[model samples]
Structures are given as C-alpha cells and as structure tokens.
Target: MTLQFSGWLPGGPTRPTTARRCELAGGEGAVVRYDERADSLDFAPDTGPHPHGLAVVTARDGHWCLTNLHAEDTYFVENMESGGEFVKVAPRRRDIPIPFELARLILPVPRGAGMVKVFGPEPHYLAPSALSGSAANWPRLDEDCMYFRVLVALCEPQLRGCPPGAVPTVAEVIERLGDGRPAYRISRAAVNHHIDYLAMHKLRVGEWAGAADGKRSYWKREAVVAMALRSGLVGEQHLRMLPSRRVTARQGPGPSRLPAPPPRSRR
Candidate 1:
C-alpha cells in the first residue's frame, strides 16, 4: 500500500537544500498547492469515495514527509543522520483516467511552481504568470508523459493477466467477444480462427463434443484454466484435472438411470 525510496544525499555531509512541499486534494479531481508552510498536511478523514491518495509536505521544522493517501498510517522520516533522501512526490489525481484530449491541452503550459485544479463541471487552468509579475520557470505540462505513465499503470494488470503461457480456448474467445452481447454465437470459422490465434501464442487447445448438437466441436475450458493458473485464482494442480466439486448447478439432472424400487413385493 505504501512505497519508500531512499538514497544517499548528493552533497557531502549536508542535507539536500532544494526541498519543497506540496499538498494535493482529490475530489472531482486533483488540486495542488505548493510552498505549504504547515507542519502537517490537513485532510478530511477518507470516509467518502473520493479520498486523497498522495501527499507531499515539508515541515517548517526542516523535516520532509511523503504520505501514501491510500494508507492510513503516518510514514516517518528515519535514518536522517546517514544523509538519507526521500522520494520526490508528484501531484497526481486518480479515478479520472487521463484522456488523450486532456493530455493535449496540458502539454503546452510553461513549467514552474504553480497550482492546478482539475475538477468541477468544467476544468479551470490558472497560472501565476497570468496573475502578476510571476517568473515563468513553470513546470512543463508534459501531459503525454504523464498520460502514458498513468495509462500503463492502469492497464498493466490486464496485460499481465494475458501471459504468453496463458491462452484462451475457442469457446472462451467467443465468450469474450460476446461479453456485452445477450448470447454467444459459435461458428466453424470463428472457432478455427480462435484456435489458430491460441496456437500462435503457444497456448494449448482442447475440444469436446456438443451435447445438443453432437456434430459441433465444443472447446474445453483452456482460457479459464490458464488464467486461473497464472493468476493463482486456482491451484496449479487443478489445471491437470477437472474439479471434483461444481461451483454452480446446471438446469438439467445428472446422467439418467432407473431408480431402484423398494421391496414392494413384501406388501
């Protein structure tokens, strides 16, 4: 939930002089305030859905603090005597997935110390240069860089789930294609294409006969099996054989057989 990065200070036997603190608020989006002189950053308890996720603050007493808004504990500055350096904190907003259009808008801004509030029914851009005699060494908008970083972080889980060793069966591929559809449609060419894609990816293929239409070739649960194994959703041994217990019941009964009659002849 929290990550810490530390390194030896660049200067010899001296602390890094260029330390700045910024407080970020997240609601509809993020608002950043620089040069905060407060000893501790103030934030409402994260009771609502839009809780703060990251904060960077430098105390007036010469201590730098970085807090993971996702975590509820105070992270302390330890081993300061050894010239330890804290991680550089960035003003970031979450929940709002950065869009390509928005990234385009921010890339042109000049770089320097400033505040950005990106919430409301519509976004508002404010710069110190526009206010008065503010020097323009502003922070470079670099929206593309930020956008890509955020996008990768958000999509990495889905990409990582699709490991080379994890392949989908024809049925699974069809199911995925039909995810938003009311029902799935299976066809010979579709199945073949799905199988070919899996084979190219070095995924194993399995097939079974359809119970309704015996001529149709049904796919085994290779996709689910692979994902379950790769993601630790199920144990590795489960991949070797079908599960002994079912998670759900089908509409029909099991293999039909004549029930044994009681010894009614005794009556």
Candidate 2:
C-alpha cells in the first residue's frame, strides 16, 4: 500500500488541495515533516509557532501515524469520509495511530488552520466466490428481502448522485419506506432491528456489543453504509425496491399520494 501527502512545501507555491505521493527509491517510507517556518506560514505568518511548530507523519501497514512536537497545543485528525468523526492528539504525543482511510490533519495557527491531507491505500476485501471460490469468507445477502429495502433507503442520497455525507436517520428511513403507503409503515423498533440485522448478522462490521448504546447506533449505521457501498453490496439499481417519488391520485382517492410503481414498470 502507498501513501500520499499534500499541503505546504519549501521553495514552492503552496497548493492545499492538490495531492502528491511519496516516491522514494528505497522501500523505506518517506518521513514528511511540517514545521512552523514553512507549513504554518501558509496560514499565519506573524504568530511565533504558538500552536504548531513541527509534526512528523509516516505510513505503516496501510494506516498512517503522526507525532505532535509542540509544547501545549493539541492537534485534530478528522476522518473526511465519516460525518465529522475526529480524534485529538495532545501536545508532545508520539506516534498517534490514525485509523482513517482519508484524513485531514488540522493544526491551529494564529488566525487560521494549517491542514495536511493524507490519502491512504483503499481498503481491500476478499473477492467474492465467483472470482476466487471464497464464498465462505464473504457475507451472503438476499437482495430481494425487505432488509435490503431498508439499506437502499439508507443509501438513497448517495445513489442519487448527492455529495457523500450522513446516512438517513431511522425516522427518515421509515418515512422513505412509507412514502404514503400504509402497508410499509414501519415502527422505530422494527427499523432499528433491520439495521442491526444487517450490521451484526450479515456484515459483521465490528464489536458493537460493548459500545455505549448512544454511540453504537450512530457508528453502526455509518459502518454498514460505508461497508455496503465499498463492497458493492448495494448500488443505484436497487433503488427500485423503495417507494416511488412520484405522487399520483389513488384509483378512487380524493388526495394525492406517493406509492410504489407497478412491479412491471418499476424501472
């Protein structure tokens, strides 16, 4: 796996958004440095290294780590793909393991922030059975089931070509599934059950049994959505399972209502 780092560099114009990878002759990974002299100057030139002076970053085993060398300021590493999830590294912290596949390291400058973007290798999973006959190593799911409909609702925003962001909450999922169809009206408990079924039974995402109840719900949904999209378990074509967005009058109705299109013409 390779690592790429992009931000401020010495003797060149700063490009905060452009990305470049480390290409050293030897197999030894590159040790990139951020010092107040150059990197911080891009954000705050006059302040004398109060919050950020130096940091060292390196990659190992498909993950990245950072060492904060300042005396009193704390630094933040954010998971850019997850919705506002971040970890804090205190002053003089050494080799803080960063678990994000894509991360943004934020150093507090005087009036602004110095940012370094880290792009790690994309995550890898075992190929499906058709490719390598490894069916036992992968999760098996039935796409025709109702649980899949719940997942499609969670992924609707992303499948519709919207920006990558938060998955729908339980209430939102219920609303999307209901869509003026009384037969599909689901209770909050049932929705939670379906999400847990996907995460625990089918996906085996992580150790959710020990996490706090409040945090478990949030992380479980995020993990399932991320894994589903990454593993090709769900896609835009499955959106047909959800109720149609069109509003048409029922056969003998006085009010317009949203309903699932006929199965023959759903596409």
lDDT of each: 0.29, 0.66
RMSD in Å for model 2: 13.5
Model 2 Cα shift for residue 120 (angstroms):
5.7
Q: Number of clashes in every candidate structure?
A: 7, 0
Where's the lowest-lDDT run of ten residues in candidate 2?
41-50
lDDT of 2 by residue, 1-267 (tens): 334444432334444544444432212334433443443322212122324345656556656677776778898886666533568999989878788877777765453555566676555566676475445665777988888888888987776644457689999999999996779699999989988898888987765434435665577777778778766677767888888897767686466577967778555
Clashing pairs in 1: 111-137, 111-138, 111-139, 111-140, 112-137, 112-138, 112-139
lDDT string for model 1 (60-121, tens) is 22122233233433222222211111122223422223211111001111122121211112
The best candidate by lDDT is: 2
